[model samples]
Target chain A: MKILVGIKRVVDYNVRVRVLPDGSGVDIDGVKMSINPFDEIALEEALRIKEAGKAAEVIVISCGTDECQQQLRTALAMGADRAIQVKTGSALQPLSTAQALLRVIEREQPGLVILGKQAIDDDNSQTGQMLAALWNRPQATFASKLVFEGEKLTVTREVDAGLETIEVDLPAVVTVDLRLNEPRFVKLPDIMKAKRKPLDVIPLEELGASLASNLDITRYAAPPLRQKGIRVENAAQLVQELKNRGLL
Target chain B: MSKILIVAEHDGHTLNLSTAKCVSCAKAIGGDIDIAVLGQGHDAVGAQAAALAGVSRVLMISAAHLAHPLAANWAPEVLQLAANYTHVIGPSTTMGKDLMPRVAALVGVNQFSDVMEVLSPLSFRRPIYAGNAIIDVKAAEGQKIVMTVRTASWPATGSGGNAVVEQRTAQGTAAGHSRYLALNSAGSERPDLQGASKVVSGGRALGSAEGFALIYRLADKLGAGVGASRAAVDAGYVPSDMQVGQTGKIIAPDLYLAFGISGAIQHITGIKDSRTIVAVNKDAEAPIFEIADIGLVGDLFTVIPEIEALLG
Candidate 1:
């Protein structure tokens, strides 16, 4: 069985993102970029599945500008057997990205697919489910725990209500949540080895998937700022303040 | 003119408050709003939906497999009803996030998630970068729109107008590939975190799981819900469900209390909408103080017990 993992490059999670003054998008000028934290977790899970002998091959796929190949190489360093880059400069929305991934899924014919439940940048949480729908396969999302049994996969999801367990057949899509696993640190030796790994760059247009973006981002703005209040001397003052505000 | 269908989130007994919030979002979009209640033996939930102020009608869908709100079964059903409506909306809850994208894909439309403001029938404003920035977006014309409303951003519609309820069955069958096994939820008597008017959250400073007992005690005394920063949850002090951050539950409570939390931007995004925030951290320069309405520069170990005693 083969596992395909989707990785995305985004502004580092620690950076304070600022909207461009002209209301275009976030300013990423000179800022550090890293593989989306969740995507790393997904890739880590794929590596684990491969290490357990449940998967024969682990392939990492990323869609972005040529710059994204850096993140792909990092995935390869982390232990993905190979890397594929869908070259496109435009920001692909979840649906369009799913379509491109669907094309890859068809060509690769992987037994399982794994992706982050949502990207930290867009926070859409859509691609995995959309890909499953496009592929007409079962989807287990927000997976915190996964177990394989014969041809069936059991996934425990962390949902709004609580944890819900579900069973899905093979050839399914699983989107990982934060608690899934701690991604391993890429070693210096592995980084050198990753450079030798085969990386195939395919133009996004060559995939023959419709890349139309249905949602148009019109403008960007900062959220309303919360005004800071005065510091209290002690618990007595804190209680008094709450009582004065009728919050107690 | 647009016709909207809202997929109501409900347990078997009653509708979740998020459904009413979605109704508010739908009403703002200027549409003939109808709600589809899909569950087994949930007629009471349908009744609640009909009583929502702006709902014009309620479509009741009862299927044995839908009793637990599985996405594989619900998506196809939503896609079936979506053909008659121009927009299909659901709350950005666990069920909505799980189900709506599949419906959007099957219907060949892109999903707009966590819609905060309905700019027009076709445009919306949503938070990106974990609420660090907001993006205004417009859906392409001539395509049916599928979106999930950020329940925290919209107020629940009041009950007044009476909408007619109609029972309808979906033509699609449940996908046998996925099956529900069990749910392990923390049972609580206090208000749910998302809907809570007041919340008491702890951070990594709490140190250990046993330390969360103080947080619960404080929350119980205040009649508030309990929450935790991702740091606390990651440290094994609480379950993932208790995590309060951008990736966790986004809450807008009337009063928020933080103990030993050095506010990270991700955690701040979740609580920025809070009416009044109070922080107790020995480190006076903790980022939480920047947004806190009342900051107490003291050790939580001492401050929390003192406040609890004072309140008692």
Candidate 2:
């Protein structure tokens, strides 16, 4: 069995974001970027599954520009056999990205595909399910627990309502949640070796993937600042203010 | 004037909390909200949706097969419904996350998922870095707009007024690729974390999974649901089912009680909207105190049992 883990390079989670001077997008002049935290969880899970002797090879795939090679290399250093980079300077929208992935899935026919439930930058949790829909495969998204027995994969999904366990056959897509596995740090020795590992670069055109842009942004703005709240000195003052404000 | 469609998500009976919340959001955007309820015996569902404070009409598509929400099966209906409506709105649940993108792509517009607030008919506010920052963007160049509303900020209204129901058939059950194999529900017998009015959350200080039982007992006594800080869940002290943090579930309960939670910024973002917050942690400097309405600087092990015994 083969495992394909998807990764993305995104702005560091801790950095506070600023709108660009152009009012068109986020200001990225000097911001640091790292592999999305969730995507790291996905790669970590793939490595663990392989370490447990459940799979033969682990392949890390990412769709971004030259900078994203660093993310793929990070995955490779963490024990992936190889990586595929679909070089597109600008980011591909979810659907087109799914199309590009489907092309790769068709070519490699990996037994399983794992990805983070959502990207932190876009906060769009649609890609995994969208890719599953495109591939016509069963998806166990927001998977917190994954137990593989024979040909069946039982996964526990973390939902707003609580946890839901579902079982799916192989050749399925599963999106990793935070609890799936704690990601391991890349050893310095492995990082050095990863510099020489097989890193294949493919273009969207080679996969015959459509790069159509769907949504257009007119402008970017900040949310309205919340009004300064008045602090009451005591419970009586609080109740009095509540009554005065007609909220009592 | 373009007709705006709101997809009604229900449990085959009462509407999902976020659906009503989305309705309020849609109304804020200035639209004639037409609700689409697809499932068996949906007349009542449609009527109930129409009764929401801002709903104008109900478009009912009732069928036994449509009862289970399969995104593969519902996208085409959403697409067909989109043909008649100018904008589409739904709660950003698993179903909407699965269904909306396909519906948007079918019409060549990218759907916006996880919108926090609508600034205008065309612009919206959404979190960019896992609740760390907010970005407001304006959608351009399409008559059709689709967005999913984050569930926490909006309150559910059961306000039912008379609304006209328009019967329509879906473009046949969307059958092609995916198949529903099996579903195993987590029978927690507790209100969903996102919808619970009161949440009793434990942190890593709880020590182990056995420790969570104490928190659960207190939650049970208060008729509240159990939640966990990310550290606790990561430490395997509690099931992922109870995780409440930025990467996990976002909740806005009426009263939130944090037991032993040290309170990371990520965790605070999840429950900051609770009306009244109570924090009980031995660590006096825990960040949970910043937003807490009441702070008890004490050990949770001693405080929780006492609270439970008192409530009992």
Candidate 3:
């Protein structure tokens, strides 16, 4: 069994994103880029699965410009055996990205496919399920815990209500959530070795995935800022202020 | 005018409030709104959904496989009904986040997520970058639209109407190797955190699980919902469901009170939609004060008890 995981290059979660002045998109020219945090968790889980000898290999894949390979190398440094990049020039939406992944799944036929629940940059939270739907496979999303049992997997999912546990067969999609496991730090030697690892680049068109989008992101703007409030001396003053506003 | 179909969220018994909120969002678009309630023996849930105002009809789709809201089993049911409506919508809760995208993929359309504002039936404003930036999304004409309504942005539609309920059986059995296990719901007596109008949240400053009880006491006294920062939940002080943040539950309450929470950007995104935010932290430099409608630089231990005494 081989584990396939997604590695997306996104604006680091720590950066305070700034919208472009032209209402086109965010300004990412000089921004620090890194692996989507949830994808890092997915890669960490895939690595653990391979290390346990339950899986024969771990393959990390990404789609986008040439820059995406940088993040794939980072995944390789973190212990992915190989990397694949779906080279595409246009910014891919969830629909196109899922379609591209389906093309890959048909060719690779990995037993388990893992991806981040969402990318912080888009915050869409749609790609994994979309991929599963297109691939006609069961999806276990927002998984906090994964237990392998022969052909079936028992996954603990973090939901709005609480923790929900479910079971799914192999040849499925699992989108990891936070609290899965801490990602390992890449060693200097591993970074040097990752350069020699097999990194395959496939054009989006060669895979027969369309790059069209029916939904257009027309404009971008900053969110309204919250006005700062005044300070109070103690709890007494706070209570009085709340009473004045009729909030208490 | 748009014809909208909302996939209802329920747990066998009561309907999740998110369904009603989706009704509110659909009303903004001025549509012939219908709800699809999928569960076995969920007549009660159907009746509850029928009670929401502005709902034209309720589609009761019952099957043994759909008793649990697994996306794989439920997506096909929604797809069967997809061709009848221009828009297929659901709440942006975990269930909808997991289910709607699959429906979109089956429909071959990109989902419009977290629709904060409706420009037209075809165009919407949604948040990206964890609410730091907003983008206007427009769907092409003649294309089916799949969307997840951000419930926090819209108030629940008032219930008084009597919409007609139409019953139907599930189309196909998709018991394809996936099985439902158990749901450890945070069966707390506290008001449902996402639906509550008043929220009281604490942070890592509460050193132990016992220290976190102060938040519960205050919440109970004020009849508010209790929440915690990721720091508190990660520290094992509270359940993860109690976490309020971009990753957790994004909430909009009438009033929000924070105790000792430093307010990371992720946490702020969850509560920034709140009507009135008040923060109390002993450290004067806590970032929570930046967005708070009222700020108090004081010890939460002292101020909490003091406020409780004053309330009494």
Using TM-score as the measure, which candidate wins? Answer: 3
**Tens digits of per-residue lDDT for model 2 on A1-248?**
99998998888877767766666777777788888888899988888889999999999999988889988898899899999999887678787888889899998999999999888787877777677767867677888888898877888777655566666778888888877778999999999999999999998788876755455555566434323334334334433443464433
Give the alpha carbon lDDT tens digit for every residue of B170-242 in model 2. 6676453344444455558877777888898999999998988998887887788889998998887866657
| Model 2 per-residue lDDT at A21 | 65
lDDT of 1 by residue, A107-129 (tens): 99999999999999999999999
Task: Answer with 1 or 2, whichever has the higher lDDT.
Answer: 1
TM-score order of candidates, top first: 3, 1, 2
The deviation in Å at residue A127 for candidate 3 is 0.8
Clashing pairs in 3: none
lDDT of 3 by residue, B75-158 (tens): 999999998999999999999999999999998899999998889888999999999899999988888889999988999999
True-contact fraction per candidate equals 0.91, 0.31, 0.88
| lDDT (Cα, 0-100) at A133 in candidate 3 | 90
Q: Write the per-residue lDDT of candidate 1 for residues B1-117, one digit (tens) a residue.
A: 899999999878978999999988998899799999999999999999999998899999998888878888899898889989999999998889999999999998789999999
Error of 3 at B229 (Å): 0.4
TM-score of chain B of each: 0.97, 0.90, 0.99
Model 1, residue pairs in steric clash:
none
DockQ value for model 1: 0.85
